[model samples]
Target: MSRIQGPEPERRLARLFRSLAPAERETLLAFAEFLAQRGATTPEPHGGLREPIPVPRPTTESVVAAIKRLSKAYEMLDRGPMLNETSALMSAHVLQGRPANEVIDDLEALFARHYRDYRAKHLSEG
Candidate 1:
C-alpha cells in the first residue's frame, strides 16, 4: 500500500516552505496565522507568533527609516492601503514624542496585519 497525497496546492506550498531559511519559515507561519484570524472580530497583535527577527533600535533611526526597514522586511505586503495607518503612527512618534522602540514594534504589527488582509482578499479572488 502507498501513502496518499494531499491537494496539489498544499503539496506545492509544503515543498516551497521546506526550501526556506528558519527565519523565513517563521515569517511564513506568522502570515498563515494572520490569514487564519482574518474573520475574527478583533485580531491579536503580531499574530501571536514568536519574533522572527529582532527589531533594531538604532539611535539615529527616524520613524520613516523604521517604516522603510519594515517594508523591506515584509516585502509581500501591499503598501498602498497601509499608507494612512503608517502615516498616523509616524505622526504619533514624531509629533507626540512616542518612544522609537514602541513605535517600531507597532509598525511591524501594522505591516503584518496589512499583509494578512491583502492575502485574505486576493487569495479568495483567485
Candidate 2:
C-alpha cells in the first residue's frame, strides 16, 4: 500500500471512468484487467510461452463472439499489439456494414499471425 504513488492517478482514473458510457466502462475495466494479468503472469518453467488454448470457432458467429473466441484461443499471445487491428476490424463490422463472416475470417487470420510472431520471438528469446 505504501508503495503506491498516491491517489492522484486513481482519482483521475475515476473521473475518466465516470465519463464513459456503460459499455465503454466495461471495455475500460477489461483492458485494465488484461494489463494487470499481462504483468502478473510469467513464462512456464520451459522458458516458453504457454500453448494457446484452442477454442474452435462455431459456424455463423458474430464479430463480438469471434473476438472473444480468438482472445481465448490465443491467450498466450500479448494482445496489446493486436488491439488496433482488432478494434479496426470490430469497427468495420459494427459501424461500416462489413459482413460478420468476413470480419471473423480477418480476425482469425490476425490472431494466427500474432501467434506466429509470438512463437518466433519467444522461441528465439528462449
Candidate 3:
C-alpha cells in the first residue's frame, strides 16, 4: 500500500502512478473497477444498493514492493507465541499420513529455521 502523506488524495495518487510500468497501471485499473462495483452493489438496510465508494488500487509494482516489505516485517515481529499459533494453522495443510515426528521436523526446518533466516536478512534493511 502507498504511504499516507500530506497531499490531497488525487494528487498523491497521480504521483504514485507516474513511475509505475504499463502492466502495473493496468492491474491497478482492474482492481479499482472491481472495488467500485463491489461498493455499488453492497446491500443496504432497506434492501437497496448503497452508493458507490470508489477505491484506488496501488500500482502493481508498488503493491509487489509493499508486499515484500511487509512480509519481512511480519517475519521479524513474528516469534515465540505468535509463531507457534501460525505454525499450528499451517501444519493442517501438510500431508495427512505423515508421522508426528516427521511433521515436527518439517515444521521446525521450514517454518522455524526459515523464519530465523528471514529475520536476520531483513532486520537491518527493514
The models' CA-based lDDT, in order, is 0.63, 0.75, 0.41
If both were scored by TM-score, which would come out higher, candidate 1 or candidate 2? 2
Where model 3 places Cα greater than 4 Å from the true spot, the runs are 1-7, 42-126
Q: Model 2, 67-96: lDDT tens per residue?
A: 777777777777778777877886686668
Which candidate number would show the highest lDDT if scored against the true structure? 2
Candidate 1's C-alpha runs over 4 A off are: 1-62
- Candidate 3 accuracy as lDDT: 0.41
**Which of the two, 2 or 3, has more TM-score?**
2
User: Which candidate number would show the highest TM-score if scored against the true structure?
Assistant: 2
What is the Cα-based lDDT of residue 11 in candidate 3?
A: 89
Q: Rank the candidates by TM-score, best first.
A: 2, 1, 3
lDDT of 1 by residue, 1-126 (tens): 885577987889999999988745754564454443334323335444222234565777655566656755565554556666776776677568888778778987897787677667656755
